[model samples]
Target: MSQTSHFTKVNRRDLLSAGAALIGAAATGLAFEPKASAEKPSTGATHTEPSATAPNYAPPIVQIQGGQLRGYRDGKTTVFLGIPYATAERFELPKPVPPWQGIKSAQSWGPVCPIPPMAHVGIDEFVFPHRYWVEDEHCQILNIWTQSTSASAKKPVMVWLHGGGFTNGSAMEAYAYDGKNLSEFGDVVVVSLNHRLNILGTLDLSAYGPEYAQSRYTGTADILAALQWVQANIAQFGGDPGSVTLFGQSGGGSKAARMLHTPSAKGLFHKVVTQSGGGEVLADQDPAALLKIQQQIAAQTLANLNLTGSDISKLKTIPYLDLITAGQAALRSVAQANNQRAGWNVIADDNYILRQFCDWSSDIPQMSGSVFSEMSSNYVKSIDKNSWTPQQVNEHLTAEFGDKKDAIAAAFKTSFPRKQVQDVLFFARPNTRALAAKAQAGHASVYNYLFVYEYPVNGGTTSFHTAEIAFVFHNLTEPQVRVATGDASEGYALQDKVSRAWINFAYTGNPSQPGLDWKPFSDADPQTMVFDTVSECRNIHAKELIALLPPPPAPRF
Candidate 1:
């Protein structure tokens, strides 16, 4: 079946014109309404409304394993915010949240996990506004959005994990992370959550004692706890525990990939969609190598605290922030000696955490892809859009790609005949190729896509990292998304198309929609769905280009 049958062919001229108009609209801060035909799906099951017994003004209430909780209504969706899923101490495994008293209010977002502030600012701050809430150790919370509060509704659930490596990021960091629109539009339950990060989550202290055996994977444990909560309580929120789908972008994507190998996470989620971050196999470390690093960190921190002992129990008594400072210092010292970045992260402990690589052989279906230009354009200096010339583009590409500059540029132009010179310089396919190869190796169905829709922000930025998020969430109307995507009618149309593909994948493990017949990826025929103004499937799009470039480094945890 031809995927192009449902899409109207979009020529280069139309795309450029629309992009220019989009940039103009963004400059003037204007909004555009989606066409009536593109507003909502006509064939999918309709989302259920609030129960007749629920009163307006008063929030809807639901009973869970712990106690009764109140949640608010935002238009057609019911939102339950900041529900505690688990609790844990510093460097310890997560435990289920204790039951609370009657009628607890889940009105506001919970505290975000502690991390360093964003020092290097970029357009990302505007695109994904950082939400500043209370920060503490007791921040293992989850949020839910559903169209129906009835236990019998049985809608498919999408659990979102935020991206920031293993260090920093919150469930509510990005406006695109909002679940209301996605819940209402897809008639499915949407979930997002917060868990421990950095040293608090992944400090390897197993050599100290068996109590800390799983401490290196506390963040993942927290996620497992959250899924367990969903399995036990999500029925009341209109979600199907049996049909949960795990989806995430960037670091979150890596986590989702890792979860596939986790023994405890086996039946928790049946499907996975990893966006731009889950392609590589996590390298295993020698037990002694990790122990050496941890021991170095411990020595420095202990001396800084004016204490002397191998006993790690004393660390629990130090002030949280103070311990973090000491840990950072120790990490830097060890990293300098090892000549690598200093930070705590997941390790293949070989006992409690055994999944060293994503098991594509499992029955869990997978869909993974990267943006067209992942972080390639972020290095470009701030210059007037009109001032950018072909010479400048060539110079930048030559500097970045060296001898392969000409070949890379030619391949990009051949692939995208209508793209601007600046856009061509930022064309990247290594990550996409890597992910496709990994997915193809898996036994279960694997679908791949290249998000080719460029958002005309500050004149134009190709499909950069994180740009496909708003579209997946069906949140093109948000101000930040508007700034990046412009008020183009085509943008909204694409949102409906892409978001529906995701919703469809969650529903049936197939991303095929009304007009698009997405095919599974394989080594012999590397079919990849290119999502643009007019989406289509293209086979082996990056084969030649990837061959010319150096192979990417192995996937790291």
Candidate 2:
């Protein structure tokens, strides 16, 4: 374990300048506006705005025989954004997006991928900075936040995938995905992308007919195509294509896990970071089940719309939003009949995503873990406050555990004696235990952490699952958003520490490069880094919890 001395200090001036380079002359795209009160966070580092006009902003053209992408200079670095990697006919499957004649401005964020509207949601699940109306099917766009416009910069590159449970999310939605702070701090290029999701991406319709077969894993396919684009053109944006790292949280982590085992994704990315959102490999279920669901939905759509053969094509031609509404209704019917969870999950596919991914390959480095008691906060808020009681807890436990009630209750009792049996059993204990076991079992170098910084915004409990995201992006003090934890100097330092560790991991395969002595997962010793007022990387007892559940049965032939 190295000490913290190896971590480099990031100049605030460089980060602000990199952020300013994202806007352009185009009115419809990103427009840089300086904030009035730039009172820096109590860290003593003040905010400095970029120069309105950078006379020395010498940008370069990335010459692709078939494609054109924009790039520009910033304080000895170059940045590119919104470069099209592939095109889709109807946002279902990705194909080669036709090349442009002149240089396409990769200056602003791209159009958002198609997803359910988030404006009316009560459960505050997904969060990002920019949200755009879905305007076209060619939503397979990728952005580059780089350090240099020239190939000579050759910095490590990181590609981020936003998570929304594969149902409702856009890469453009959260402000934390910004590359300025990270790119400047680590001297790396960062990319965030948009791709097909939900019914638009995964409907398992392919088992239904020829049209449907192309629909399954479309989101994963979109990601592969984006990686292909990175391999060919990231150098133009001053990035090292060979050193690309794929990272995401929540739903995005779920996707990255699947990609780890995917044949199509082989050799596309060298490193992976799974933050608080992985290890729930799908339980064995009938493959034919999805096809059946799709067929039932198709039938329902035709009947409800009162349409014959001629109207069927019109149904397909209807806007993406209308199709989404019809799909939601169809899914509701299936869920009612089968008792499905609210969000459709990443299914194991023999063709696209192999079951081998679940087996834990040792070839790569994996960072996997969860927030402390992630599901509890949501569980507490979901139940009717007036009707909440111990009896209600018992009833809920019985409903969830069924025949396994004794086992579940006993496990919860031992793990969280101070808390209610229902909260601990149903939410926190199972998840954290599950994640740690899965990551440890894999052959790859594994790093685990528990995010426990409780935010005052969430009534002063340790951090929640998604709370670490914005802070990891170095956006904790932004006025538009509040950190779930209180505004304290310790909290800020923890943010910097964790975020730096992430950047360090992107730069090198290990989280502790020059500064910290971070240890990877081993069969003999399972260590986890605990993030709180003071961070410590050490091991805790997990064997008892793991023994509570039988080993996951081998995958069926």
Predicted structure with the largest lDDT when compared to the true one: 1
Model 2 lDDT tens row, 371-448: 765645543454432245878777776776577776766765564343445544324432444344445556557787
Pairs clashing within candidate 1: none
lDDT of each: 0.78, 0.65
Candidate 1 local lDDT, 1-557, one digit each (tens): 11132468688588998888888788889865445875675677698877866654567999998999999988898999999998877778878778988898787898788875455765656544555666877788999999999999999999999888888888998888889899999999999999988778877666677887777788889999999999999999999999999999988998887787677787789899999887655443475676677667667767777766565678876766777777777788788787765566665555555535345336788888878877765425444433557787778777767998888777766666556545655566645443454454566788888888866566655677787888999998877667757778989999998999999999999999977999988666777888888898767457776666555555432
Best by TM-score: 1
Off by over 4 Å in 2: 1-60, 71-77, 119-135, 282-285, 294-315, 342-344, 358-361, 378-427, 430-442, 458-461, 481-486, 513-515, 522-524, 542-557
Q: Which 10 residues in a row give candidate 2 its minimum summed lDDT? A: 121-130
- TM-score, prediction 1: 0.83
Residue 505, candidate 2: C-alpha displacement in angstroms: 2.0
On the 0 to 100 scale, the lDDT of residue 152 in model 1 is: 93
Which portions of model 1 miss their true places by more than 4 Å?
Answer: 1-55, 118-123, 283-295, 355-361, 378-380, 383-387, 390-405, 432-442, 549-557
How many steric clashes does model 1 contain? 0
